[model samples]
Target: MFTSDYKYKDYIQEIYKTFSPLSWLLKIFSLDSLSRGNKQKFASSYWALAKGALTFTILAAINLFTIYYKFTWFYVELIISVKYADAVQMIYDLCQYFVDLYFVYKYGSDVFYEYIRQYAYIDGMFGMEYYGSIRRRLINVMIFMISMWFSSSLSDYVIWAIGFGLMSTTFFSMAYIYMFIKILTNLHVTVHIMHIESRLRVLGDLIQECYCSSVSCTARIEDAVIKKNWFYTIKTKTSKSQLYPLKKISYVNSNEVKWLSRCYLLLTEQVNFINRMFGMRPVTAPCWTKGLSQGEGLPIITTLGRRDGYRTRYEKMQAAYKDLLSLVQSQPINFHMAHFMRLDYPLLVSICSVFVTYTIILIQSI
Candidate 1:
């Protein structure tokens, strides 16, 4: 899932798929067109995004300014004197939109190189199909998010189209940022975790084969030959001080072991990086330890990650693939809604919830 043989455009395509419309907007920001453009001839890739965000932020500020200037605006009689809550909430959301956009601008290149260029560049459909299954895990969640947004939007501005229209552009700005965070997170999961899953499965098989194959019997045969040679040496020397031979053990699958060891180390490194990227434990593959150890027990895996207090790497990976993605459960989209939020579900829910919560007041006031 995270191969590096392909070019950067593949990532653009994948990122593009998350939401093509937003990708198009980001492109105007030079996400693709000016990727190779120098600042001499072009501005920063985030220029368009920054300009767009600023425009919306300005609009929201004006609305907020108008609301604040009214003085009585804070206490809209929307129930028991909510006081500045709605105004404050909208201001907070707009600020959040700024923060989200800033993260995108700063990390834009690093993310492209790390995910799209390095990990998300899969070569074939066989791997993609498996990865796609894991990716779709969030589809239900996405559907729920979209539906909630629509319903809340429908209910919030039933009679106040003018007010809603003023607020709509501001909210759209935040939604764009939300969508960007989502696409980035999904790419993270699809490339890192799913790729880990696929690699670990392959590793488990390799480990199982290395351990289960006949390494022990070959040693026995070598021992028998050594004994025979020892007898012949004694006869040939036939006297005096005896010479002794030291037995040196070797892996029958030494080449295979070396290859597997390299593969395992690389795979674990990848897992560690991904886990750390989102502030999870450095050794997260072990989250699947119990599941992988079920039914089949370990069979002579010395190079496993067990000594460092993690389960066998392969097993952990197996479990990781089967387990529910726990990167950001409280979030509708992983890591996107993490921490503070002014815009996104928090803001959307705030606007709608507050609107509905005081809908009765609106009816009375109107």
Candidate 2:
């Protein structure tokens, strides 16, 4: 029952044309297409073997240099042969392998979410896509725990000492990383929630506009009337409750009803998508707070201890919800407002900072 004011479909087409190749690359990995020759070959030749050989060779050289610097000029005599060193050297190589795999999984999913954000930008220059990729990367990294543990084991201590001052720097900074990840993930979830909500509001406005328009109303009134009668009939028959009678006193006709029904179905589908996006499907463990009221082990972000900074953000989100309510009540929903509402700007800034800090750490480590 909704009508577009402008040619949104054309814009969507343009976005797809511009961004399809990137999406296609992500889809290749996202779908787990291990059997595909290109994927398998890429993994074996470029990722698996090449990376493995290079890392092992580097580690062996490092071991040789360590021995030579410490003791005699005959580094090979002090240690086993470089060939034998390859075996123990593989330990470091294995670490690097998993770290690289973790990076692929991390940044790969990040790039995919980034594509989604870019598409959203076509709808409007909404910033939901801004930190969306960060959240996806963080969550993927968290879930990909095996790779993280392996990274720690493979850490080149000597390299880190020379590069980053000392291993103790990373050790001391670990909690910051964890906190940043948690905050980023939570903010991401909230942003996604806002995006879906905004879309629904826009669709709702479109439906209202289409129905309230002169041409569509005139064309569909007869259909709306017939369907309204059928609706009452079915509903009355299905329920024995006398709370309200199935009144045949409805104004809508069949065509209008049909149009509205289609609109309602679309809206309902969007709702379902929102639920799924929030991870409410097959209900898993909650991300942040659990209880209705904040308490121990709650993800519901409350102000206490060193968390006072989040209070302002929490209030801002609450204010955004208020704006959402006002938009839903207005005609021709303001998607610009709705779009902005989905992002917690403060949280986004924080997450962005985390990326900056982590990148600095990674660079320093290297």
lDDT of the candidates, in the order given: 0.39, 0.34
Model 2 score (lDDT): 0.34
lDDT of 1 by residue, 142-181 (tens): 5565566566655554544455554543433333343443
Name the lDDT of candidate 1: 0.39
**Model 2, 132-215: lDDT tens per residue?**
333354346444553554455346444555675753334323323323333333443444444344333333332222222322
Q: Model 1 TM-score? A: 0.43
Q: Residue-pair clashes per candidate, as listed?
A: 2, 15
> What are the models' TM-scores?
0.43, 0.27
lDDT (Cα, 0-100) at 241 in candidate 2: 12
Extract clashing residue pairs from model 1.
Answer: 2-119, 93-342
Q: Evaluated with lDDT, which candidate comes out highest? A: 1
**Model 1 alpha-carbon miss at residue 140, Å:** 3.9
Number of backbone clashes in candidate 1: 2
